[model samples]
Target: MSALARNRVGQYEVASDLSFGDLSAAVAAGWRDFRAAPLYGLFFAAIFAAAGIGLSYYFYNRGELAWLIAAAAGFPLLAPFAAAGLYEVSRRRLSGDSIGWGPVLGAVKAGDGQLPVMGVIAFVIFAFWVILAHTVFGVFLGQSGLGATPLQTLLTPAGLGMLGVGSAIGGIVALFLFAITVVSLPMLIDREVDFITAIIVSVRVVQLNTFLMLSWAVIIALLAFAAMAPAFVGLLVVLPLLGHATFHLYRRAVR
Candidate 1:
C-alpha cells in the first residue's frame, strides 16, 4: 500500500466519546456485518466448544480440588488460542474478508509475538480476580461458620449472602478488566497497534459508552452461561457468533 493509504488506515481512531447513537449504531452494524459471515462463525464456535468440552471433561473427572488447581494452570495455557481467535475476528472484519479458517489461522501464526503478550495480560488479570474471589469466600466463611458442610456452605442462606457479596466485588473487578481489554486484543491483531494503545483505547471506549458496554457484557455472560449449560455443547454455535460479533463491535467503535 502507498504511504498515504497506510497513513489513512493507521489514522483510524477508536472514539472515546460513546453516545447512544454510537452504541446503537455499533450494535446494529455488528449484527449486520456478522450475519454476512454466518458459516465462518459457526466453524469458529464449533472448534472452541470442542476444545472447551474436552478440557472440562478431563478436569471434572479429575476431582473438584484437582479441577480448581487445573483451572488456574490451564487458563494461561489456553490464553494463546483465545488471543488468536480475538485477533482473527478483528482482522477478518477490518479486511472485509470472508471469515475463512485459513486466513484466521494465518493471522494467528503471523501475530505469534502478540499472542503470548496478550495471553499473559489476560491470564494475570484472570488469576488476580480468582484469587480475590476465593479470599473473599474464605473470609466470609471464617466470620460466619454458618454450621454447614462445605457444599452446604455455598448453598445455605448465610453462605449465599456471603457468596453474593464476594461475587459483587469480583464482578466489578471483572467488568473493569473486560472494559479495558474488550477491544484491545483485536485492535492489536488487526492494526498492529501496541498493547498499551489498544488497552487505553479500550478503556476509553468503555468510559464513553458505559451503559451500552455493560449491556453488551451482560449479554455475553448470559450467552456463555447458556452455552455451558448443556455440557458445553451449545458453545459450538455461541462462541463463533460472539467472536465475530465482537469484531464487528470493534469496527463500529473505532470508525
Candidate 2:
C-alpha cells in the first residue's frame, strides 16, 4: 500500500503527463525490488511455473489440443493474482518495513475480498474467450472431420479462415481485458476501493497513456509467449519480473 495514497474513500485521483520514460524507470525499479527480495519473487514465480509446466505436460502427452487452447485462453486469467505476493513485497519495501513470509502472506490474505472480486472478472473474461474460440473452431472446422488429419487440415481454406477470424477476435478480447485489468489488480491491492472503481481508474490511466500502455502491454505479451516455450520454465524469471514491474507501474501511474 502507498502511504501517500492512504485513506482512500474509493475515489481515485488519476495522474497525467506520464511518459515512456516512466515505464523504463518502473522496469529498473522493479528489477531492483526483485533483486532485493529475490526469495519472495522466486517462491511466488516457481509456483506459477510449476503449474504451467504440469499443465503443458498433461495436455501434450494426452494430445489434447482443444483442451490446450482452452487452457491457454483461460490460464492467463490467474495472472493478476499471481502478483499479489509481489505487491506486498514492493509495498513493504517501500515502507521501509522488514520482510517476512508470514506477514506478507497475511497481508495478501487480508485483501478484504477484493482479489477474489478481481479474479472473478479475470475468469469471466477468459471464459468468454474460450467460448468464442470454441464456437469459431466449430463453425469453420467442425464438419470437416479434420481431427484425424490435423496437419493436412490447417492448410485448407476453411481451416485457414478459421485461424484468421479467431486471431482477430482473440486479439480484440485480449486488448479489452488488458485495458480493464492493467492496473486494477495492483490498485485494488493498494487502495481501499471496489473492483469497479479500480477498473475504471485503470482504464482512465491507460486511455491517458494509450501508446505507452500499449507498448507495455506488448512487452508483457511477448514475454509471456517466450516464457511459455520450453515448458514454461522461462516464467520462473519473466512472470515475477513482470509482476513486480507492474506493481511499480501502478505506483507511478496512480499518483
Candidate 3:
C-alpha cells in the first residue's frame, strides 16, 4: 500500500528483492487467516481430499493402483485452482471484508471470468500430465504389469527407474505450473487483470526472486506429498495452510 512497496515493471506495479523473511511472514499470515476461518478452510480441504480419495479408489478398482504415484506427483498441478476459494478467504481477512460462503464461492467470477479460464488451463495441464504419466509408465514398466501388488511393482528396478523418470518429468511440469500460477490465481481475485497478464506478472515475480520462489515451491511439494500419504486426510490441514500462505505471498510479492 505504500510507495516503498511498489516496484514498477513495464506499466505494472510489482514487488522485487523478496527474501526469506517475506516467505516466513506470508506463512505466518496464512496461518492466521486459516485460524480466523477454520470452517471455510476445512470445507475446501475436505473437497480436495474427497476428490483424491475417489481417484485412488477408481484406480484401485481398475487394478492400476500403481498410477497413484504419478497421480500424487501431478495432483498438485490442480491445487492452484482448488485454492481459489482459500484466496478469497485470505483476501477478505486481509482487507477486513466480511467472509462468507457466497462471496468466497463467487470469486471464480472476480476477474471478469479469468479465474475460470485459469481453471480450464489447470485441468488441461493435469490431463496432459496424466496422459504423459501413462506413457512413461508404459515405456518403463508396462511389461511387468503391476507385479503381484502395486507396492511390490513400484519396488522393482524397472519401477524405480520409472519413478525416477516420471518424477523428474513431473517435477519439471509442476514447477512450470507453479511459476505461472503461484501469484496469478490470487492476483486474479485481487485485481481485474486478464489471465495472460496475470501469468506474465506471476512469472516476473518468480524471475525476480528465483531462489526464494523455488524454495517455496519445494516446500509446497514436500508438504503436499507428505499430506497425501495418509489417505489425503492431512490435506485438510496442509492445503488450507498452503493456500492461504500463497495468497499472502502474492500480496507481498505483487502490488
Give each model's whole-structure lDDT: 0.61, 0.77, 0.87
Model 3 compared with the native: what TM-score? 0.93
The reply for model 2, stretches above 4 Å from the true place, is 1-11, 144-152
Estimated TM-score for each candidate: 0.73, 0.87, 0.93
List model 3 lDDT by residue over 74-122, tens digit each.
8877877778899999999888899999999998787878989888888
**Candidate 2, residue 15: how far the Cα is off, in Å:** 2.2
Q: Residues 1-255, candidate 2: write the lDDT tens digits.
A: 673343232456666557888898888878888999888888887887788778767876897666566567556556657778888888788879888998766655435887777777777888888788878878888786357788788779988888898879887888888888878887776767777878788888887778889898889887887877767778777777888888888888887
Candidate 1 backbone clash number: 0
Model 1 — TM-score against the truth? 0.73
Model 2 lDDT-worst window of ten: 3-12
- The sequence of per-residue lDDT tens digits that candidate 1 reaches over residues 110-225 is 44466457667666776676566556555666565434356776697767876687658756766866776677766766776767667777776676667878887777767776
Candidate 1 residue-wise lDDT at 8: 31
Q: How does candidate 1 score on lDDT?
A: 0.61
